[model samples]
Target: MCSLAADLATLFVAFALANLLVIGKFVGEPAKPHGLVMFAMIAPVYALLAIQAGVYGIRSLAAVRETILRACWAFAQAVMLMLVIVYFGKIAEQLSRLTFVVGVGFSLCGLILLRPVMARLIPRMIGEMPAIAVVIVDSVPFTAPTGTVLLDARVLGIDPVRHDAEMAARLASAVGHAERVIVACPSERINDWSIALKSLEARGEILVPELMRFAPAKLDEYDHHPTLVVAGGPLQYRDRIIKRLFDVLVAGIATLLLSPVLLLTALAVKLTSPGPILFRQQRLGRDARLFSIYKFRTMRSDMTDHAAAQLTQRSDPRVTRVGAFLRRTSIDELPQILNVLKGDMSIVGPRPHAPAARAADKLYWEVDDRYWERHCIKPGITGLAQVRGHRGATNAHQDLIDRLQSDLEYVTNWSVWRDLRIVFATLRVLVHDKAY
Candidate 1:
């Protein structure tokens, strides 16, 4: 209903704009713009672009920067199509270059501007929409403080509780007014949360763990037992065959093209340091297997084992002059193409962790059991974790945990196109030092 209506509106708007540009350019009559033909052609094209850009769903509220970037891409695709049409139809002479250019430029600008304005206004209008209120009950109010810190800036109307009584009162009130209620309590306070939730459930209300809270630590505090439920095995043989074929094809091609850069990096690392050129470390691979991961040496060989395992700080003393430059620019990881070729890794997957990183006591692993689930796939030379500003040493537990979450998400949504996109994104971030 409403969702379908909104989707249709977005599709129609984009199509109409694209059509105006095409028709205004092709229509021979200068005074008559052939608006009808423009509408017919542009509407379909716009709908296609909108769907491809993921503008139909909740992503329609993407930021100005994202909107502009997507619009530019859509415009480029449209221009390519128009060129093909004109070439085959012999309509180049009939089209007005000025009109086409102006029309595309106007449409792109309008769409980009429209999104940011809508992003700002739409939330206010939808603020009253159904929301899950998280009641944080703890003896010391630890859960409450942490819950407040975890509030997503984008979502509206999340209420937090400080004590059991407060949680009970809030839960009763929300049962009367809100559509849902989630209780976030410490591990020791599970009894209280369960009791409160049961009381609400007795009155017939929906409660789900997925919408409970933002703090991963709070969620993990409750679900501590390993519930072994064997559902389906790993990918079938046919799927594995297809995936491996793709890996080899892409890796082989990439190795051939990137050989020169790899050679130069090796030479640079060797000349920059007195130690070995390649830094080979034991890293956990798929199914918890160990593999030797390769990268150009970016630190002194004399560095202590503790220093190697610890996160490197900005302007680390162990970093050689050339190593600093290489690390910042990500030239140090260029040699990992050999890893890709050797079939020890993929071009895109979870970034492998050192063997020492497997300790569950580590802050990141302590956050959730799913943290190690990232190892379900081959570690990537460059991944969503690295591209999203998660590189270097993690100073805080939350940093590593956040990076792990992104890594798992990348694995769950893996695709060849997504891998290519991540590679390009890594390059852009490295060049700009956006992830340092």
Candidate 2:
């Protein structure tokens, strides 16, 4: 929260300075008040861009270079968004260009200037973190990380020779005193120790891999320490909040902006089809929960088998004339923006599958044990698979595998920037031949 406050303060100060230099009393002209409205309009853009670029990422631990880099990256992205909006909306004609550049420049400089002060004071402000207790068994070949006081695994009640009751007592004692626990054991032994460590309540308990099955696609920081997620099962609480915010903001904006097109498409579906205009189907969402996803109906209502489980193929007889055009243009998917708004789905995630979905006549879950892992996050209306042209019918085993691979890859390595890029890429796929 302090970090957010600091960034917001920095932003306003930059804006003020820019206004002073570019338009106001700095050159002896009277200060104008109209900047307030402009600030309101552009503030959130900077905030979101800053969040996406790791501005609120672990500042206490970051060096001066890292602090500057992250801030600059965020400001650059914010500027790009500002540029896009400016060009399309002709904001340049209404606002001073020098003010824009100076504000951004001041923001970057202000952020860099503050880092040293923050780095000096943060430790004192937060107080020294209770040194984490790293418990590494002898098999893992121990090296202690900086700032953490070591805890003896054997003293903490682990036995390489035999597992026993006294170990639990030691583990309890150790956890009681420690701020957190890092259990570094061999890959095979992590499960047993993880269960044990979890029983003892700690602020955080992490299992570091000596050697693990699959490499993590990304490494992120947690509590000023490096952390790795095997499945990337759930996002960091902050990232999750950001992702949800991104979904709601983007989904809401898109719906409002595309309302005319949405209405026209609905009319097209209604006029060309013999049934309902919006198609709603039950599909597995986050955590495998069934949710009703909305789309503009592109096929005749009578096609049960294909509608229920089978993927549509080229020249599929079920497709209505309007449906074909909607499918081709990908406008049929516009209604699912509601799904995104309603929290049943994300704007970017694994593509949801029908409850009875099949690939090569086998249930998708049956095809890969890792398939269910993809449900760690909400299914998306437009996903990495769809953007990668892994759309259309699923026939052979490899097609399912290919799409699943993309889905899993997306889940394993996801960030807001990555999601935005994928969502943008989905535009190309919508009109590409693969979407059919």
TM-score: which candidate is best?
Answer: 2
Per-residue lDDT of model 1, residues 137-177, tens digit only = 33333233333222221132213222222333344444432
lDDT of each: 0.55, 0.67
Candidate 2, residue 322: Cα displacement in angstroms equals 1.4
Clash-forming residue pairs, model 2: 157-167
Model 2 per-residue lDDT tens digits across residues 1-436: 4665687787778877787887774332333333443455566776776665666644344556775687677767766876787789865776666777777778778877877777677678988644444444435665665665666676555652332223434455554434345655666765555445433323334555422444453254443434443332356535766998889889989988999999888888888768888888887666555678888888888883533766778888988888888888889888999899889899998888886667778776557545655665788988888877787777877788999899878876889999899878876667866555
Candidate 1's error at 306, in angstroms? 8.5
Measured with C-alpha atoms, the lDDT of residue 413 in candidate 2 is 82
What's the distance in Å from true for residue 194, model 1?
Answer: 22
Query: Top model by lDDT, which number?
Result: 2
Worst 10 residues of 2 by lDDT: 160-169
